[model samples]
Target chain A: MQQTRTVELGTGLFVFLGVVALFFLTTQTTGFSGFMGGDAYRVTARFDNIGGLTTRAPVTMAGVTIGRVEAIEFDPERLNARVTMRIDGRYDQIPDDSEASILTAGLLGGQYIGLGAGGSFDNLRDGDEIYLTQSAIVLENLISRFLFQQSQEDQDD
Target chain B: MSVLRELGESFVSFLRILGDMALFLLRLVMYTPRGLLRFRLVVHQVHNTGALSLVIIMISGLFVGMVLALQGFDLLARFNSEDALGTAAALALIKELGPVVTALLFAGRAGTALASEIGLMKATEQLSAMEMMAVDPMRRVVLPRFLGGVIAMPLLVAIFTAIGIFGAWLVGVVMMGVDAGSFWSQMQANVSGDEIFEGVFKSVVFGIAASLIAVYEGYRAWPTAEGVGRATTRTVVLTAVSVLILDYMITAALL
Candidate 1:
């Protein structure tokens, strides 16, 4: 009977540890925690092309993540990608004129939104749209453009 | 004509196997409620399958984590982005390796044991004796073991992931002198709740598949020593392949 009790206790402990691991896995790996209750405000930005800017991409201000991309949709009339972002309530000091640009961490890393502070006292409110936006850089387009320019120069020569 | 007949026979046999497995699964689901009343038996099987399997799971997790850290470190060093090693290792383990490896290991270790044990009991006429005595072996025997296995699997996978992450930390930070703070911070910035949910959900599915296949193979094994051996082997093979296939399907659908 004691042995059976021990086994049961062990099973309980094993399950507890598993739950702890799961807690760590969720909190440590992800930006949000259970305690946060998602206290964030949503904002929107329009870009000519989002490129590989996936949903849930981080929104950073001065290298620190202040929000995340919540959703991405295409606006039919404007022919641009509409990106919805959820900014943490604590970082509400961002100016309305600030620029939101899609950027990669490295040359071949994941995409994120980099916010550049603008020279203004006007604070961005909830559901406010950022007008100044830059889309993701396409390397192929830049390279091809460069090659096309070089070929034109050679033809002139 | 003979070749076509052989093909037809094989196809019929395959359909028969599927039908038998489906009925067996239905019986299992029906008997589960009755089996839950035998709580002591379930506890005993949990002790046997889960508690006993912990050691192997931990060892494998640690090793897999260490190797991931080593490879990640090597690859990241090329671009001077060694600080991202932690993120890479953690993502690989939690998202993919942890649950899949744990399921594969569980199938080989506990799954085989469950199958062989049932097969042996069948061969010895134990199930038939219980039937003759007006007892349902499906409830008294098979269901508890299956339930215990299903309960234990996710826990084992969780432990594997935890140990594997620790192993990565040990190798990357302690052994190789990577900046521990950056490693952890990068991981926090990159990983999300959806990814962890995917991992856990995948393991739960794998657990059900592994446990059900193991018990079903054992219960249906022919009443002979060779049949028991074959059943155990089939339990391992079928569980492994199905786990991989399901993992792919789930990953494709979810990610």
Candidate 2:
């Protein structure tokens, strides 16, 4: 009985240690976490449809996440998703006219707010709101639109 | 010609049947009472699954980490980027290999034990005896094992990652004479929090799958001794397959 108990305890310890090692191994593979809160600058963008947007989602400028989505909300009257973002503070000073479009990081990735720099001289300050926002291109809508256009083009041809 | 069409129809029918089964499973998961909150059962299962898996998890992780270091060093040496060996090993262990291999080890060990124990119980009419005694077998057996597996898998995954990374570090920094500072510093930059979360998520699911299959096969075991053997065999195969399937689906979406 004692031997069984001892063996069990030893096994439990081994499992515990192994899992800790696994996490350590993974964190080293993908180099993303820096000084968590210190890396990015914050801003807000609003959209009619956020779709799969969630907090902690990437806020990319020119396809690089200078920040992340901090919060998401829907206004009752407007029915639009109001997204707050924290961008890398150093990458700040985009002119107020910069456009934010929702984009997929990949085929399986959730939506992220992508910023396009504009030609305006005036730059966006911290706590500033980005007004020119484009929502996610809904996949179902795009598929239907493609099929309909294909049939139309066929008829025309 | 008619036979070909009939075969095609049958194939589609089979696929639709599988889809229906999947939907039922989804509903079953959805409707499962929050009975997973029994802390003692959870504790007991954790002790069982985790304890049973410790030595194998540790040794496997260690060797995998070492082998990764060796292979990574060999490959990266060609690129003169041998410095990235630590980071590469870390990522593979954390994201893909660690949980998967550990769960695979578990699919052979604790998973087999669980199936046999439950299978034997069924063969001996012990499970039926419990049912007659007004004992909720699912609550008493399945829930504990399932919860334990889910919790323990992640914990073991964490252990594997830590040890594996350290093993890589040892091989790279000490044995191979790679600079310790660069090896570790690069790791800090390359390994992201989100990746860790993804790894953890995968392992947890793997654990759940292993536990569920073990219990399911065991519980469904027939009264014969052969049934017990069949249950054990099925448990391992199903658990391993489930781990691979779950890994693919989760990683595909997460990435």
Candidate 3:
């Protein structure tokens, strides 16, 4: 009987540890905390080119993640990528005129949308679109354009 | 004529085993609603499987994580991105390595024990004795073990993943001079819920496969010592192969 009690206690502790680990893993890995806490709002942005931007990518405001990219679609009439973002409710003070730029984390890290606040008192609400947007800077395009310009200059010389 | 006869014999046996396994699974499921009422028995088997298996799971997690950190750091050095070592290790452990390794370990550890224990009882006629007493051994013995294994597997995998990340941190931040802040922050920023869910889902499927095979093999083992050994071996082999195949299928579908 004593042995049984000890075994049950041990199993309980083991299971508890496992649950804690899983909760830590879930919170650490994703923007799930914001969604699970029910404290996020949706907004949209339009860029001329999103490059390799993917759905579920983090949306950061001043280095801190506010939420994630919910979806990406092509706007045929505007000829650009339309990105839907979910921002945390706690950070609701984002000005309506704020700029959203696609930025890379490091030299080879993944790209995310970063928000630079504007000086306006008007705040962004759900479904509101941020018009001031910059697309991902494709290094290959810049390099090729630079090469083309140099060759043109050489021909003129 | 002999070669053809042998091929035919093997194929027939294969189908027979498959049929028996399917029926065993059906019976197990049928017993579940009532068997679940025996919570103490399930807890006993949990002790037998989960508690006993913790040491091995933790040891494997640590070593796998250490190896990942070392190898990842070497590879990332070329790109001058050693800071992503934590992310690489965490992602690998959470997404693929943790569940796969834990399931393989469970097959070798708890799975074999389950098969052999039931085989021994059958050989000793204990199961039959229970039947004579009007007690269904399938519910009293088999169901508990099955539920125990299924419950134990995901917990084991969770522990494996957590320990693996810590191991990676030890090797990356404590031993080699990588920035601790970057390692964790990058891991946090890149690792997502979908990847974690992928691992959890894989483990659940593996748990079901491993436990079902273990109990099925045990219950059906020929009532002999040698038969018990063979059944145990079969449990490990079948569980490992199916887990790998299922891993591939799940990863492909999820990704």
TM-score: which candidate is best?
3
The global C-alpha lDDT for each of the candidates, from Candidate 1 onward, is: 0.89, 0.76, 0.91
Supply the TM-score of chain A against the true chain A for every candidate structure: 0.91, 0.74, 0.84
Model 3, range B107-164, lDDT digits (tens) per residue?
9999999999999999999999999999999998999999999999999999999999
- The regions of model 1 sitting more than 4 angstroms off are A119-121, A145-157
How many steric clashes does model 1 contain? 1
The residue pairs found clashing in candidate 1 are A29-B191
Clash count for candidate 2 is 42
Model 2: per-residue Cα lDDT at residue B205: 83
Model 2 agreement with the true structure over B1-255: per-residue lDDT tens digits: 999999999999869845754553454365345646556556667777887677777778788888899888888888777777767887798889988998888888788888888888888887788899998776676666766776787787787777777788778888998878767765654567777888888887888778777877787777689998998998888778878888999999998
What are the per-residue Cα lDDT tens digits for candidate 3 across A130-153?
A: 989999999899999999999999
RMSD (CA, Å), each prediction: 2.3, 10.7, 2.0
Give the CA lDDT, 0 to 100, for residue B78 in model 1.
Answer: 97
User: By descending TM-score, how would the candidates be arranged?
Assistant: 3, 1, 2
TM-score of chain B of each: 0.96, 0.87, 0.96
